[model samples]
Target chain A: MATAKDRAQAKAGSGLNDDIGEQKRLELYRTQVVLREAEQRAYDLFLQNLVKGTSHLSLGQEAVAAGFAGAMKPGDLSFCTYRGHAHTLARGVPVEKVLGELMQRDNGLMRGKGGSMHLTSVDHGVMGSYAIIGAHLPIACGAAWRAQYKGDKDVSVCFFGDGTTNIGAFHEALNFAAVWKLPVIFVCENNLYMEYTPIGDVTAVPQPAADRASAYGLERILIDGNDADVVYRAAQIAFDKARAGEGPSLIECLTYRQSGHSRADPAKYRPEGELDRWKLRDPIKIYRERLLQFGVAERVIADIDAQVRKVVDDATEACKAAPPPPLDIIATDVYADGGWAWRN
Target chain B: MAELTYRDAVIRGIAQEMSRDPDVVFLGEDVAKAGGVFKATVGLYEQFGPLRVRDTPISEQAILGAAMGAAMTGLKPIAEIMFSDFFAVCFDYIANEFPKSRYMSNGQVKCPLVVRTGNGAGSRFGAQHSQSVENWCMMIPGLKVVAPSNPRDVIGLLAASVRDPDPVIFLEHKSLYPTKGEVPDGEIVDTLGTAKVLRSGKDATICALALMVPRALEAAEKLKAKHGIDCEVVDVRSLVPLDTQTILGSVARTHRLFTVEENPRLCGWGAEIVSIVADEAFYDLDGPPVRITTPHIPLPAADILEDIVLPTPDRIAETVRRSLQS
Candidate 1:
């Protein structure tokens, strides 16, 4: 097997520290644990009819959300797809607010108006979690355009699946961003499947970023998304280039979903032995093992895990206790009631 | 006051707004260099340069959805959709994304933008190129639909739409682009939900919008001079915040309601107006509300077929006379 240093140099570029410091490693591990445990608890809640609507769990994709969250600066806007619970939590939106949103409570992120599929937090720079596939890509470019026009250094990040690359909006948005030299990052979490169908079956090329990046004149980088350190390092490279006005970049993260597509799906379409192999390379386990090798004590890791469980537990309890939104809220917020000619 | 075409009025309205607000921008296909397909944005590129007045590729999805994002991020964008029939190319963005962002976000974000597109059928652009789907837009909540009949109303409504803090679907009829009328020199912003009374009478109330407004006025004049029957014409400038109160008052006096539109008769704007009159002024109405509209079919490329299918001033007058006899 190749040494840790060799693997790091191959995946995350040369001359970088193979092992992250204890503090950062522990933070990454804790974030993943919280995300994984929270999703599992939310799934249980969904089964018991506590959380309404269908929620897509990101069981194996926690590391990507956590890593991107770590690298993003304050006020950097980001958008994600329906499978975006972990992305919201990773952005520092309280677990109470997220779980409350899923449960449709008054204290939810959007005051219970937007359910699981539409989580948004302008305060945390998590713009929206769109349910329509490949629709929000153009909106991200628009945000990037505003940032560029105002001379703001903040970069807009759009996280989507491998399937979104095939839509017409994807090509339009990418082409516009390239032509305008907008400051944004397109992170394609290539989880190998677009819903039930393998991406290879639908996409013309095996690797979407590598195939189409040159056509748009954008820089392409592929990384092992399960490795949090590698993801953070690669994202930094793209962010620096974008901040320097070098234009947009595309990063293809190779990862997998540990569970089915949604709350009700069984994912029987997945090939045999594929799940077992991917489970062996679970992101949380990989990061934990790497942290152990970095001289972090076992007891410390265990303590962090215990603390994460408490946070998830408390958040769930809070969500359960929250009240539903009132009926009068229906007529409110549809338009800014500014004494217009329409609002007679 | 100066006389200007409907096209020039559109340009003047947008230009005036752009000069008033630094954040107002214009983006569409050929809007910068080619000065728009209808020449509605002529001379803006030279005045605002490339940044404020941008010419995007033939991507309606990008133009519309990006306008939503830009509006949310502190820019008031006026995006052109080329033709109202092409809204299907970016319907999801207009219907699902921008319209609901404000409500779904609990009013945290607002899309202060105008989606300007040419609507209605008269120039024989064929089925796909020519359509008056204003009713289709009126059905959607969170979207304000406005169609002006002349140069003055076009300028006033366009300016009001840009200044408003929501998504406004400003529908411009293709046939009215070259129609000339006197327009006030300086800023003339009109209220959205207020209908204009083009003519006043007591025999019958004729409600019309867009291209049908002038035709309705002509029908009213004919009814007066020929039949000794006076008709009042109410121009529905705004479709969403419908000025039903004005229509109700006119219907009460005239005791007869007749709606005229250029769109298809089935489930069209005229149907909505008749329904409102039925509900609010049923006892006051002397007869059943009459709707004069085009037949339910795609507009043919030939001018003869189009003219036969569309509602004309004579047909409207005959409908009014028949209603009065009843």
Candidate 2:
């Protein structure tokens, strides 16, 4: 019996070709490996300390973050779900602050008040990532609509899990986003589970999650989420389209989570051969394989790895040594101005 | 300065703010072509265009949630809930998100939103329409509640509210809108969070907000001529960030306190004032703090029963005279 990869090789060596430009496509593919390595390192750190809260590892889902954040311009806004560490890190919110936030330190994003669920930075336009599954969609629509009202050239993105597709807010927000033609991208990381329950069990409709996007009249695309190049090109097309006065886009990235749901559970229900099957599509392994074939040296990869590790270490030490915000900070900024906090 | 009615003053203030700040947008039911039921937002749609002066969906929750979002993202939004009663639908947004966003965000953002709604039971519009629940907003932190009575106070108070950094719940009395008074339309904006000692007398100080201010004034006049009581009428303009100093000062001087309100006796804004006075100025009191408020029942559909349910000038004067004696 011929294997799938072996039979395709025997049929044609060049006919089923890679339909992409060399440099841009190769650069994005390379980023997939970097992100995968970075996330793996982050996961290794988690395993080392037995870090608290759920880390929704972007093992297979790394392409969505790299593609969207890679194309994101300054002043662009994005809000994600509770499993948003990858999203936050992709948006350039420092890994230390993201980790510090996860650790519930005051110096972290949301000043430790918003832990694993709520990650926010208004300055960078990572508006908020909430634990409440569907709440941020309304918030994203509100912000994007306001930007349009002000004639500001800002686009927003909302990230949700495959589970959130069943939520009423998902339907309402998508409709609202389309009706207003708001500059928003609805990125669904369909890792095939809404926590423990399989996505098929919950959602009536399937595929692309973007298949439902047509009902809202938004542009929809389904890509190999494990392929960073495909995700980046698709995301770039959507981003520019939205910025050019078109409406929202629903891009469903089909991927799988390699870790347990959070710090808890073995994710045993993830089917018997599923993990090993998906592991073959590992984003980091594919990139290294491509780069080596492209004549990129192993020494360069080693250097890049060293550079990222040093940065992560410096960030970890800095955050560990930093003091938590004072208790008086709790009373400040309730109204964004003045003594109207609890004083009023 | 133009001598304007309370209604005209608020209209002019909104017009001026809407003109100066492009981000200063207005949203309410029937506010666009209908120009608001009270006509306070009259002529705004033409001046600012439909986008800025929007006619939102009838859902109060959606209106407020949208306003909360708009304000959070830099637009200075003033959303109108037709009557104070409708605000019940939006209390959670106000209580949870609007009040807590800034704190949770670590002072990184502020919701500079103004929820312009009115309270009072004068219209005989039945229970649903005639609810004076401004005190209900007092429960939320990070909200500024201001109730302006007269044309001048309305003009100044609204301007102050428009410019305030925090979320403000500006309560305009329906009954006082038609009442004519000398309002200043000038470079000067009225000070925020300060109580106006509208009338100064010695026997006792009467504290009132919004519609009750006029009623309290009428009662004070009656006390002066008929009962031989020198009544001081203090308009507690801004309910939150309340001018406690002025209230305590007046209470300390007169050694007597009486509060008048259109809201029910239980947990009314007047009760909050009386409680503050009791806690802070207990030793200064010559007599106990007296509250003259509407009964617990909702405002009735019939004019006679509605009047009976709410506190009239006569009732306020009776309460004041009793406080003076006992």
Say which candidate scores most in DockQ: 1
lDDT tens per residue, model 2, B1-326: 66787878778888878877788988788888888898888888898898888776565655675677677788888889999998776665667667766666667666888889866778989999988888788877878888898888777777788787788899889888788887554644787779989999888989998888888999989988898999888998887778888988898889888888788878887788888888988999888888888888867899989988788888888877876776
**Candidate 2 clash total?**
1
Clash pairs for candidate 2: A54-A262
Residue-level lDDT of model 1, residues A1-344, one tens digit each, is 22454345437542346545667767778888878998998889889888888899989988888888878999888898998899888888888888888888887888798889988898899888888888888888888888888788999899998889899988988898899888889988888889888888888876765467878887656778788887777778888988999899888887898888888678999999998899898899888888877778899989998988999899888888888998778767777773223424
What lDDT score belongs to each candidate, Candidate 1 first? 0.86, 0.75
Q: What is the DockQ of candidate 1?
A: 0.58
Candidate 1 off by > 4 Å? A1-10, A13-23, A338-343
| Model no. 2, DockQ | 0.32
lDDT of 1 by residue, B170-276 (tens): 99999999999999878988888889889999999999999999999999999999999999999999998798999998999999999998888788988988887
